[model samples]
Target: MFKPFINTLALSTIAIATPLIIPIIAPAHALTEAQVLERLNGIPVFTITDDKGAPLLGSAPQKGSEKPPQVLLFFLNPDDAQATLTQIQKTNPAVGSKARIVIRSMNDAYEVIKKNQDKKDIAFQIVPAKASIESARTILTSQGKPADKLPNVPVFFAIGGKDKEQGLLTLEQNGKQLVPFFFDQKDLQSLIDRAKQQQPDVANATKIQVTSLFQVLDSMVATKDNKPNPDTERFTFVPSRNAFEYVVKNQPATTPAPATKK
Candidate 1:
């Protein structure tokens, strides 16, 4: 399982006291701790535990599955969080439930994810990262996203679905590179339009605004261990770190497909 957020408590010790000291602009109206926890109700989650009955690392079940895309909002309260989630859903029904939206930094357990299932209004679920600071850093580093101040609210990721082998092949055959963007509403629409037409996974769709963000992302990741490169498709977006993993992370675990064959 891609479980890291829950157990990142160890890394939480590393904190930014004067967050705004840097020039990085953060996300708007991200969830507060309590709100982050509450949204987890009923969404599927991936947890990491030791042999003992202690919770270690875990991730909210907010994979880049469904249709339109999946968004991960930071630092928002309940009301604000709901507003952003609702607005995104108003997209074409073809993309409505296609998106999986979530918030993080809730009470480090795995209950709210189940709550989403019981109440049953949200088409997709919101997940909480028991400890998200380190996970944020990891995601930024891995995907070549910058680190000024990761957004706390109104932050979102637009994820699309895949038909498995065919999707991976498309990326490979097309020589496509997945781009990640921190977009405002207007740019977000640009991404949505391309995603709707091509239904690319988030990375692929980001190519539309490639020059804007990739330059920074490439630099950001260059300082890390696993920066994006050729293997991005094979390791990050393919069978190992690719779209298939996104689908499997939230769904019930199944035997992993063999590395090579489709």
Candidate 2:
């Protein structure tokens, strides 16, 4: 009887080992893109907190209340965060009443927000970064990016509600339609580096012509199929082209024009 029991135990061990010997297939996620989109569309809220840990948007929209278009700016580096905030202020007249500007900031963003909170030009809010990262990751994942690939620093997005008609959905500059693009500090730095190499005069100039700089980058991308490839949320967007244009037109000669690329 002991011999029989030992044999049965051995057989059971082998059965478990056999499966392990083969490659294990990872299970697919249950939610499809359509399902995810449906759920997201229905829940158009990004739950985040203020520097004080209070809800950002009053917990939730009043039942059946209409949602506005939201322009979100995420920064990796604190230094760059201020630039985004300044740009929004410069562009408020053009972006007027279209949508509210929301900047994602770490707990550290509190002081920065306090400094500029009195500014009346921009309709803006500073949201806690920790509370917003997961939502950003969810969006990134939906765009086909792995969670680990998410940026540690700063990025920006202009999110629209399911109903597109009521928000800052599209931009028109000299008749060309513009879209929002997501990019990191590295991408911006690369553009600046290349500009320095190819056009040192412009790079070294006291005041950079943002329109000309943007034109150069646009030409480079136009030749190639350079498009923002986000993995999670389908943005149908581009970087802050309008904001740059606004800054160039509104700011004084000393203000550095924003340099960004696709």
Candidate 3:
């Protein structure tokens, strides 16, 4: 089925073992470039605010300027999202403007921002967008796949401009399991350039490798040649705002505070 690709898309692993008793497998159909673009644009988008309740990024790009290509990232935990943002700031400062980095979180943005309020310069926008998150869950469920499950690590969609077409990239856990993923400004620039082109080479996109999330952390980092096994952890659903409150109240304090983004 497309489970391997789906796992790659969600940054969640899946294990497919051939059973002793063979079950009928359906033939999979490749998505046309147009259908892929439509689905990419159909991915829900919404507005978000900072800790002060001021709006940050809106549902769509600003008027008067052509919409920039976007990178939509979904994070299971706020801490992971913040950690990734910190790495970006330290490694490559210009990634924010290179592509519109939109981070989606199930936790409330106000509290998520409050947790890292000491770090003022993080470039990404984290929003507590539950409806949009649920929409993702619905689509996955209807596909006869696992219901209510999403990627654990950062799941990235490189969305093109003009037509809003997209390519998928996921940062699966590195072989050492020390870093979830890494990327730099140059990587974003490449995606942005691809989006700007009139006719993107869609076939080449599907074969793209799922690389390390630590490209920002270490330039020498190497990627695993093989895909990760299916992640066994089950997805948990909670009210976005409520998750933030719980995390804020109970988040461990023993870990030393991280340095702010430069």
Candidate 4:
């Protein structure tokens, strides 16, 4: 019943047609706002919205006030977003019936938060998929680190080297070597599997590292004034496969061609 409406909404606002793993080069100068936004453009997030395209909000109690802060949930997985919408539908059919999934770039959400930095009544939170979080916790525990301290929406990367000296694993695609940072642990595992097949020499040395999206973005911004190294790696962001697949499947349809003249 909601398929037509979903398609309409998708066609109207879906700017991304496929999952993109964009390579970002470290600049010689400090990262500019434009640079950060450009890097963020390649990563997509999902959110549920009404027919009017407004995100649903929830409240949490404030630190020292009777009023609570309104939080806008940005999901890393389309399934998680759908699950949330389903719960809403069960609890309140009126809003659920009109709600639809909205695909948006990470930059879109960043801009929203940036524009509202001065506002005290609202907050924006990126909700990581539960499976991803569990995988992250397991990784942390295996690394002898406390799993409870894992950051929200952790990004994973693989590195390989000998004698405690390690470097990020690079994959060759389109004849160019690129480093990939995955938003989902399962995706990283897939990459690890591929690495073992393609680069057997370094496969055994591979080690997983975890970091948050916020930390990476901040590091990029903070490196604007630093000197650029010629050997600096080009980093690629691999969004969650589930989210990426969802966007690709529902991409806007191509317009029909006009009739040819006789």
- Which candidate tops lDDT? 4
lDDT of 1 by residue, 154-215 (tens): 22233333333222112212342332222232333443554444444433533221122222
lDDT of 2 by residue, 30-132 (tens): 3332332232111111112233333222222234655542222323323344444345446654433232322221222322333444443222332223423
**RMSD to true structure for each model, in Å:** 20.7, 24.9, 19.3, 9.7
* Model 3 Cα shift for residue 64 (angstroms): 57
What's the TM for model 2? 0.21
Each prediction's Cα lDDT score? 0.28, 0.28, 0.29, 0.64
For model 4, the local distance difference test gives: 0.64
Model 3 scores a TM of 0.20
Q: Which ranges in model 3 have alpha carbons more than 4 Å from their true place? A: 1-128, 151-154, 157-198, 201-262
Which tens-of-lDDT digit does each residue in 1-262 have in candidate 3?
1111111110112111110111112222333322222222212212222333233331235467655423223443344445555665566566422322233222232233445544423323433233434444554565565754543222222322223344232222232111111112223334434433523454234221222221221222222442222220111111233233434454443322122222
Models 1 onward score TM values of 0.21, 0.21, 0.20, 0.79
lDDT of 1 at 186: 37
Which parts of model 4 are misplaced by more than 4 Å?
Answer: 1-30, 62-65, 173-175, 222-225, 229-233, 253-262
The stretch of ten residues in a row with the least summed lDDT in candidate 3 is 2-11
